[model samples]
Target: MAMARRLVLWGVLAACVAAGAGDWSPGTATFYGGADGSGTMDGACGYGNLYSAGYGVNNAALSQTLFNDGASCGQCYLIMCDTSKSTSCKPGNTITVTATNLCPANYALTNGGWCGPGRPHFDMSQPAWENIGIYQAGVIPVVYQRVQCSRSGGVRFSLAGSKYFLLVNIQNIGGSGSVGAAWVKGTKTGWIQMSRNWGANWQALSGLVGQALSFAVTSTGGQYVHFPDVVPAWWQFGQTFTSNLQFSY
Candidate 1:
């Protein structure tokens, strides 16, 4: 009897730990980008190739409600097939994915648009979807929660745009990966705030050529990080810079 009592106590403790994890919210999920997730490349987040951006195949295109007009770019989500709602769920399985695109609503399709406006849906990469559900299910009821992103190395900045317009796509961010705001500074100028161009890209109309660049970024979670002189004076328009600093998860 004592041993049984101890087991019950352990079970209750484990349940408490699970409850303390991020609050699960209801949603639906579907697979896309083929079985290898190759079709998911060059998504709306401006991340280019998922592999090149360090997001790998574990990525998803979120519905408008969750996409937040690209403000949710680079954010991470923990998803699980809700076994209580579907028999196709791979029980006890969950996957973590990064938001890399938008699952636009298709008003033309009859009952086919799961990612319509106001709906919290995830059009996940095939590999990611398979991790938590059977392929035959196609679409499944799911529960997901926003979670801190886990990334290797530090953040990366890909530079683009023309002589007067500077566009930077920030990638491989950790913690709350969605960037709320960003600012750039040159060796000779004061901090110039950048505007969200689209997706994870931030733009500034200032000409900052031939100057070593630094950046201050703030996440949607309100955490701030600064990378000083991350780009050298010789930086080119197509160059990408890496910083050794990252936000804590």
Candidate 2:
């Protein structure tokens, strides 16, 4: 079945090749490693979608994943190379693409390790990495949000309420969320629950449960961890209501 899918994808790509646009538009979205191209993904596991500049409601679950080098933990990708010709670049070798195509905004790519650019016609994979996870690196349905804000149900000098929301922001890599968080002047007296839609549930965060890691999310720059909020009293405002998460494939 998987082979059939690969053949189908290859066939579609080949047709594009026939039209002299195999690498047109999307421009050869490539993955060169992994167990026989079983895990070379450029999108999310459940939500890999493409939308026009102004289209909405694009939430489709993905059927497969992209991987490169199954036995290896981490690998580096060098794309937009020289398109010069066939080459057998090794793990430590720097493969160059000779293709001369400008990178369109939607024509994006990412790898576990750092990649380079400026040259054209390139698509090679090498080994130089940090983290080792097959499910890493891809243009996913970045789910930035705010979820689970609460306060002590009944604690000393604290009141509780359960009016929560999962702030949703549909953004791409390195984008910021719509909120921020901080340790309210008086937050050593309660607890809350919050998280971006990393998995659709608010899991407790570490430290200063209510006021920890509270900072304005200028960018989706950290782990999509959840932090609970508190609404102790009518006038009680938890300064830490400003947290968010970023989902990457």
Worst 10 residues of 2 by lDDT: 66-75
Candidate 2 residue-wise lDDT, 12-79, digit = tens: 44554576531422122233334332222222211112121111121211111212111100111222
Q: TM-score of every model?
A: 0.91, 0.20
lDDT tens per residue, model 1, 184-208: 9999899999999999999999999
Model 2 C-alpha RMSD vs. true structure (Å) is 17.2
TM-score of 2: 0.20
Model 1 Cα shift for residue 186 (angstroms): 1.1
Provide the RMSD of all predictions against the true structure, rounded to 1 decimal: 4.7, 17.2
Off by over 4 Å in 1: 1-19
Return the top candidate by lDDT: 1
